[model samples]
Target: MAADRLALALAVTIRHDGNGGVADDLTAPEGLTDWVRELAEPLRDALDAEDFTADTAALDAVRELRAAVRALFARAVRPGPPSSADAHRLLPEDQAMARLNAAAARAPGAPRLEWPDGGAPVVRAARPPGFTDADRLVAALARDAIGFLAGPERERLRACPAPRCVRYFVKDHPRQEWCKPSCGNRARVARHHRRHRTES
Candidate 1:
């Protein structure tokens, strides 16, 4: 994907507006455009050294790919009843499809995952390789994105308490505060304003 696509997509989803011009986390903390780059680097490095950025355009390209992969997985997990037609079966994708199918067939206890709407059967039965393939695909997404965090953050990455901006942040210690004090304070002020309006 194009550099801007990766960078913009991540920026939009992660919405780390604190720094928009330059990307960080994936490479030099100066190369990535979002926190995912930073989070993904360690795990991505484990997959391949060249899987990350070296310059501006390259950084954005992979960053966008990262965001795209997230969207893809989200699509896979959508709650809608499966279509009777097997609208999005993972088979026929490539060698991965064949491997995944065979693995599913071997598992005796696998759930027979089929379309909820009576579409073509997707998961005919529970398969052991289902998760492994998904994990591998996540790795592949990371590889394609050039970097990606290992998935959920180490700690419970919190969202800022501000009503207008729900930004995320890494809690440094047990005594740590909000994502940004100013934002937190602003939110408190807004709450107070609402209270006064009700009082009058």
Candidate 2:
């Protein structure tokens, strides 16, 4: 489920700023580098080393993949609206799938089995040698997104509808309606204001 978490993390790079606007955490090479480092534990397998640096190309590639992933996420939540920030600009579903698949193919990983002492055997996708850091990062993100879309977690995915909030999150419990507590509070406040306006 690490890959699933990673996929969700990548999708959430586009989020709501506290000031009622959209904010992107991966807007530049430095931002990408910081994000990778912040999620170093989940990204360790995808990166060649702990000090992985990003470049302009890497930033562009990641942004492209993010668009595709968000499109697919919108598809997954059919009958429900996607995040308001980019819902009007989602890529076509087929194009998004193709892009994700192509990115995942960049690294060309093979399945590797490992059996740790006193632990269960595990099978993981192992990237071949000689790929660039950008290739690895993009491939890892795409592969994780593919896995997440195909897995059971896809059923739990929801686009938070809180005012000015644009996020996709897995519903942890049956009653969960927002990505977090603050979002829920914001949503309630918005609803209350709407009701008061209608009455006035």
Candidate 3:
């Protein structure tokens, strides 16, 4: 399945609770490690290479980053221009700018022209030798999220229409209004019930 880039990064922090609700999953270090492993390939490789072990300090740092990213995504999908001021409110102004700057600097580049097959090459960002694996992973994810947010797919990003569902998804077609068919059906059923109650 095609990966949902920004959504995947944001998803590490929260997930559907067994009782049909969302709950925080990044409350501990192991949860953070599990979340890192589930990320897309390039990002996963960076984390794996470092033999990075999650600890409470790293967990806290990542959570702060996640909060900034989530806030950015929420604003991106809104009707108007996303506020830079609002972004700074969720994260330290310098940290927010640094993440965005790092993302811009490392956004994926074109495939190598010297590949034997003359086909799409496996593009990997060149990290300096001194950079730790954990640094690469965090940078990769932040870049992924920024690239996705700034690209045309931003138009397709939508918050799920179901009243109780907090997830976001990309609209697959012009008429697609909900994150999934179940959400669409739930919305329709709710509207039907509302109409019946008003008429009765």
Point to the candidate with the largest lDDT.
2
Tell me the lDDT of model 1 at 63: 45
lDDT for 7 (candidate 3) = 41
Q: Give the range where candidate 1 is weakest over 10 consecutive residues by summed lDDT.
A: 81-90
Candidate whose TM-score is highest: 2
Sort the candidates on lDDT, descending order: 2, 3, 1
For each candidate, give its TM-score against the true structure. 0.34, 0.91, 0.71
Better of 1 and 3 by TM-score: 3
List where candidate 3 sits over 4 angstroms from the true fold: 4-8, 15-21, 49-52, 80-121
Residue 4, candidate 1: alpha-carbon lDDT: 26
> Which residue segments of model 1 deviate by more than 4 Å?
1-60, 65-153, 175-177
lDDT of 3 by residue, 1-200 (tens): 14546444453355444365667878898877776666545464344633566788667666666666666666667773332323234565456657655643433333333345857656544445665554555566666677776788778776665645556667778998776677788789999999999999
| TM-score, predicted candidate 2 vs. hidden true structure | 0.91
Off by over 4 Å in 2: 1-4, 114-124
- The candidate, 2 or 3, that scores higher on TM-score is 2
Global lDDT of each model?
0.39, 0.88, 0.60
Give per-candidate clash totals: 22, 0, 0
